[model samples]
Target: MTKIQPSAPLRSPHGSLLRRKAKDNPTLASILGSYEKFSTAALSLVVSDKNSVFALVEAFNAYRNEAVYLFESGKNVPQENLRSTMLEELFSWLFKDLFAILQFDQPTNYWAGKATSSYLTLTFAPKNFQSLFEDPNPKISKKDQDFAIGATVAIKVMASKSDDSAPALTVILPVVAIECKTYLAKNHLDMCSATAQSLKRANPYCMYLIATEFLKMDSEVTPEVTDISEIFILCKAENAERKKRQSEGKPPHPMHADVVWELFSMVMGHLRAVWWDPASSLDRGKVIGRPF
Candidate 1:
């Protein structure tokens, strides 16, 4: 994939919860540990880049069998809640590793569409991308453009019908779209013209831009709109000492907290937060909706 280097120094906000770095570290053991909590009946299919996918498959299978055995002996009977638990654990672990090397500090928000199960789809839209004005050109649908922005990483075990039924594209964990634009363009005429040439989708006429990070709509995007109460900014955390004090007291200033909270708040409303610690072989625990 050709890397589209940022034109400017995409400012990295502070205090954003980020993915942990463990690409080279021992993630196999972590997978194994998570696996040891399911039954043999449980099916798992991992489709990923060839480089690391095989080892991951093997490690998981071994862990699954061990987990089944452990449950059979009545030691740690696979939690009946294996699916949700495992999903949260794996996601947290992976994101943690990714966090360590990520450029931004925004706490990655996880959300699920109306789809059943823990499966989700991530959508990313850069605020400045010219694609904002482009129409969804039915010609370039989601499937054709799956990798156009970023790839969807989903677990394939949730779709199992029977013991023999192969696990197809089961649950879509998240469809993370990168460099997405939410607001209207500064130059409507220029944006409209550019949209004609761009192969991206435009915001639905009814949709409104939810500002985050440093993306503030100027008069160009919304001329008459002056103040928006619901919309909030996603910023970094500074003055930790003052925040600590404020928390202890009532009415903490919003600016003191990390921008991660904004994303977290948005996600918490729609999806559950699953905590996973990639650094340890332990389950960070799953909270079905909301953190703190």
Candidate 2:
């Protein structure tokens, strides 16, 4: 009988010191193990949500696949262009599904639009609870009202419309706001934070998100931007670029799949919180259950 050879122990790509530390520390190991399991479960949930979650994943995959194909075909394409195009497409795709799912009544409609807020025109009035513009003691600034430009993607829901004589006043309050970037810079982050803060002041329930292809800022930077609910690094550098960076002793950006899953989880949580109408429960029971 031939003697069977024993397989060598599995090796990690990390340095010996780091590997040793990981091996020695049971708490660290447990945390890592739990994160892995949690990520896996979260990803599964994201992929399984048939409404908008799966559609979002598919859109990202499509863009990545196209980028890979174009690069392989010897086409000279700027990665920034591809990233920008993908972000635009994602905005349309996501909002379309979100609008359909969230829409119920005629006036309460959802759309991708601007969310301009002016401290001069709008004041926080205690007496006039209905309208934001109804302030007893209005303090109008002499200088122009500093306006924070709305994000590329914003979900606006119509609040109320006055009588026939009065022009249909639409309250452009975005429940979901997203800022997309190829590479998120500090200045860009600051701008987004400012915009989000303004929107939140107008409507406290607004959810602000920042999505970038590359993470130029450090992890600690996100916490400092308190207005943003979350930051998603949608896709790292291309495969070739990532390998080159690794070779140069640099860490690669996060994978697209991981970021998509994180985004999906956040969106699903938000939907669960606001999607259902308690009054319509009985009506829903009477009607056949159908996906929007």
Candidate 3:
């Protein structure tokens, strides 16, 4: 199949916010405009090499500083997932360009995974056979990843092993999943761990990752014991009360280019890796190690 060309996002998470905006809204207008600028800049230059990565990084950080960090508190932030939705759109714009260089044709949704619920799924019914003409009711558990490459497959099943069929069994499998959070607290970390296990159970080769703007844990906590591949702290801020601290005149922990580059490298390595060949690492005398 032919691959779709990379382009600016046709739609964004701000549709509802835009619809709900007061006639004289200014902050939301500025934020939405900044998002468009970043999207345009991202597509204007394709990340063909490391030099291009630098240009993209400059644009990416600029967006975070101007658009993402401007508002404070949910009451004034427009939407709780506003920042996260921006990340999803920006990452998809950038990653699509990068993936174009890799040039693999596959049926994976890049930016839209945020709408697809999750990286795993299940199907169940009493073989009701109520769906020969009607649609099946599949229970979809929402994963709602920030950035993910996955697909949902629905297979309609036969009722009693006969030609008559029942509700379809749908599997929402994510091959590579990235959860985006504005800030990750301890509780969020626990949820991430459980989600990682759920993804792994469905596809052992799945790459589960977390990308958070800040660490909100009471103390520094590592996720080594968890099945998550890695957590990218985009801005390694002193956590616990970053918002209150920032409101008190602390400097914004702007996302570092280095951190973004590290994330890009990790993703590329995972994409190029051979996960299954048992002897693939024997010649190197080492196992497939996760890159930090």
Candidate 1: residue 191 Cα off by (Å): 8.0
The runs of at least 3 residues in candidate 1 whose Cα sits more than 4 Å from the true structure, single-residue gaps closed, are 1-140, 143-212, 220-232, 236-258, 273-292
Against the hidden reference, what TM-scores do the models get?
Answer: 0.22, 0.48, 0.76
Give lDDT tens digits, candidate 3, residues 1-292.
2334563233344433443552456666766666567667766776556676777778877776765555554664555556557556555654665456667664443333354556365555433576633443444455666677655666554434455545565556666788887788888999999988877876787788898878877656768888899988877875655676667876566776677777777777777766666576787666644333
RMSD of each: 22.6, 18.4, 5.4
Assess the local accuracy of residue 286 in candidate 2 as a C-alpha lDDT between 0 and 100: 38
The candidate 1 region of ten consecutive residues with least summed lDDT is 12-21
Ranking by lDDT: 3, 2, 1
Cand. 1 Cα-lDDT: 0.28
Best by TM-score: 3
Task: Report the CA-based lDDT of candidate 3 relative to the real structure.
Answer: 0.64
- lDDT per residue for candidate 1 within 1-292, as digits (tens), equals 2322322122111001011212232433343335433211122322122322333334434444333222223344333333123222322221222222333443433331222332223244534545433321112112211111122343333212335343344332332211122122344323332322232222111111122222333444543332111233322322343345445853322221223333333332322223333444245443332222
